[model samples]
Target chain A: MITKNRKITFILSLISAIIGIMFAIQLKSNMNPVPNESRSIAELRSSLQKELEKHKGLLADISKYNLLFYQYESSLNEGDSVSVMKEELARAKRMAGMVGLEGEGTVVRIQDAVIPEPPPLSDLEEHSYIPNAVIDEDLRWLSNILFANGAKAISINGHRIIATTAIRNVGEDIQIDTKTIRPPYEIKALGDPDVLISGLKLEGAEENLKLAGKQLIIEKHDKLLIPAYTDARVIRFMKPVKTKGES
Target chain B: MANRKFYLYLTLVTISTGFLIAASIESTKARNTERQNEKQFQQETQLNERILAEKKENHQLEVQLLELQRKVSQVEEALAQRQSEAAEILSELEAARMMAGVVPVSGPGVIVTMQDSEQAAASADVTKYIVHEQDVRLMVNELRAAGAEAISINGQRLVSNSEIRCVGPTIIVNGVKSAAPFVITAIGDPATMVGGLHLPGGVMNMLQDYVKIDIQEKEHVEIPAYVGDGKMDSSAS
Candidate 1:
């Protein structure tokens, strides 16, 4: 009986030791703190901000080169041959709308005409919701008129209206060379302000402008800044036929 | 009495041994699972490091590109400043040809072809079925809006003062009269130009209502310059 008691006590002591070791390990693991979620998120945000700053720096460098190139091209040179070349270059630049010109010009602002609410009268029934509001054709007509009246350079909303520049409606937006501009459209013509203003008064122009349901605001500015064309002018598809002894 | 005491001790010994075996097995399984978690954590950390390295490399390459661009600009400026009379004249002549749309240019662009609907002959209003000058004008307008560097309609280069007007059954583009189907070749970024035309309710949608229009993105497109008379007379003062 004494031997049996000794055996049972030994087994009980062994089991208790095993239980104690397991509990100790679990307690140690639980005591360690969990990772801080907020800290990790803050780290991620900081990295993203750093990346964006780097990207901006690169873009600024590119623009700096662009400005320098423009300045170099516009600088005048000496000598007879160089002068003639310069003159031709200047002419080409103007014709291509690559140079910004400032002159006494007229600014025509065209905005959507606000239709008044119907007064609930029988005569006013047809007047509600007048759908005409400064469509693409109005601007085209005005631009054509300006050109015909000897406007040297014309720009609409900073987009130099060159021969290749097209004013078209893309889903309620007027896009000029991948740039979408909104009303009120400011059309600037670099010419005699008086002449341009008078040109707008030509036959069928004023009538056409009024019928388009646009609020027309015309004024004269002594110095209007028309921006240069900032897109590629590379030509392909039609080569100049070689004249006699041209090569 | 002695036998009963022996049996009780034996039962206690067996129960304790069972408890020891169970605890060891549970601990080993927990350790194996924890090892897998650690392996996953290490892989995640390696991926993060790779991402950081790649980003740093990208930044370095971008800086190099910027530096090279500045160098090119500087060189160009110097060259322009020191160019001889003949060189300047030649360059200006080339520039003139480019602006006049008389020089061939090759670049990435999109090609658009418009064909009259074959089924339109049976329809009452065949005018709407055929590609009109208005349709060509709208397409060219959209292409220009999409930043097309150069554009041509059925091999006629559109330069300054080029007109697209309908004369009876045919369309006159740049004084070169052509009937449907008009092929418009433009040189620019293929994707942006195509995207601009294909935008919902855009030029493609509007033109597709009348004629069958097909657009394709080409990696390289060649546009011939204006082959007509080089009339620089339209220079507006």
Candidate 2:
């Protein structure tokens, strides 16, 4: 009996030690930081792929600028700098959203969804819940999706989106660049219509709008014109960074 | 009696051990669900490192591109000094470039930093506590309305075509992925921008519940020039 009792105690102690070791390991792992816990492997790969493509684009841009610099230097020596400067200025104006653009692209229109009238006194709580109509965020997302799909220029209700342009919501109205726009928002984009349509489809733009009690209508146009930015505020706060040999 | 006592002690020891084992297993299981297998973890780490390295290289290229652009501009400036026609166009070009965000600018402005709230990770509704692209967009819009002349987010210059959006857990600005806390630098009147942001029922009031935002007024804020070609694929008439 004495021997059996000793054996049992020995086994129990062994089991306890093993459990203690496991508990220590569990505590250590819990303390370690897992930064990528929320992201999956597929997501990581896609992000990395995007970064790679951006890197390639950056490389091409660097080379293009280098060539431009050489061209400008030689033109200066040839005494034909005025024409070159004029052409460069024109290009700059286009990039600054100061000139209108035309191309084959897509136009998307969003309008409020029609809701049927509910029975009187069915449920007071249900009647009190009002669906949100088209808001500024929806427009912002639509434009972003359009841009991501290679849209060169985008305008909503004739308000061209520029670097400084902001689409916002003020009380009951939506404003683009501080100008209030009414319902039936028409968004015109300059790009390949097929690509833009696919981009929107991939994002389930129509379904998302439907969920928010809005209807999305997409149309393809062979020739679409997007207006230039109209609100050109005087740039009073910023001055260009001075380089060497400049006044 | 001695034997009975020994049995009682053994039973107690066994019961406690069982509880300890159960607790440890439960904790470990929770962690396992959060993390994938060893191979996946390794791949993720490698991918992250590679992406970071590529970003660094891109930064270097951007700097080089900026230098080339400045040289071209200097040549134009020199030529402008010699001729009156060239001088008129040169000034217009400079202003256009600044408006296009192709050139870097500096002035007195405000720097706004936004981060996810401390309780975001612990909250069940993480979306409510985390920052979204719309929040950043609203902030930028408010700044622009307050007369901000230049703006950049996380060192990525905002051009006419720049899009601020989210993919999964990352915020993609100007085609580059970044995570919070986002630092937005805007060149404008410091006081006016602050006032605009602080207005009742403004962006600050809306986002105060979800995000932690800090705005600092500085005398000098340098916004970098955009580094892309800025060329429209379609025809510009």
In model 2, where do residues sit more than 4 Å from their true spots? A1-51, A76-79, A112-133, A170-172, A202-204, A211-213, A243-247, B1-56, B121-124, B230-237
For residue A221, what is the lDDT in candidate 2? 100
Interface RMSD of 1: 19.3
Fraction of native contacts under 8 Å reproduced by each candidate: 0.13, 0.57
lDDT digits (tens) for residues B42-113 of candidate 1: 655665665487567546645554454445334444555676654665555555646656445666788899
The DockQ assigned to candidate 1 is 0.06
Candidate 2 lDDT, B40-88, residue by residue in tens: 7688789889879987887777667667777887888888888887888
Instruction: Pull out the clashing pairs in model 2.
Output: none
* Residue B150 of model 1, lDDT score: 77
TM-score for candidate 2: 0.77
Q: Write the per-residue lDDT of candidate 2 for residues A1-247, one digit (tens) a residue.
A: 9799889887876776566656666665677665555468787788788777767767776776676676776773535667777777888888888888888899999977766775467684665645577888888889989888888889999989988887778889998877999988999998889999999999999999887778788999999999988765787889888653121
Enumerate the candidates' DockQ scores in order: 0.06, 0.38
Instruction: Evaluate residue A114 in candidate 2 and report its C-alpha lDDT on the 0 to 100 scale.
Output: 69
Best by TM-score: 2
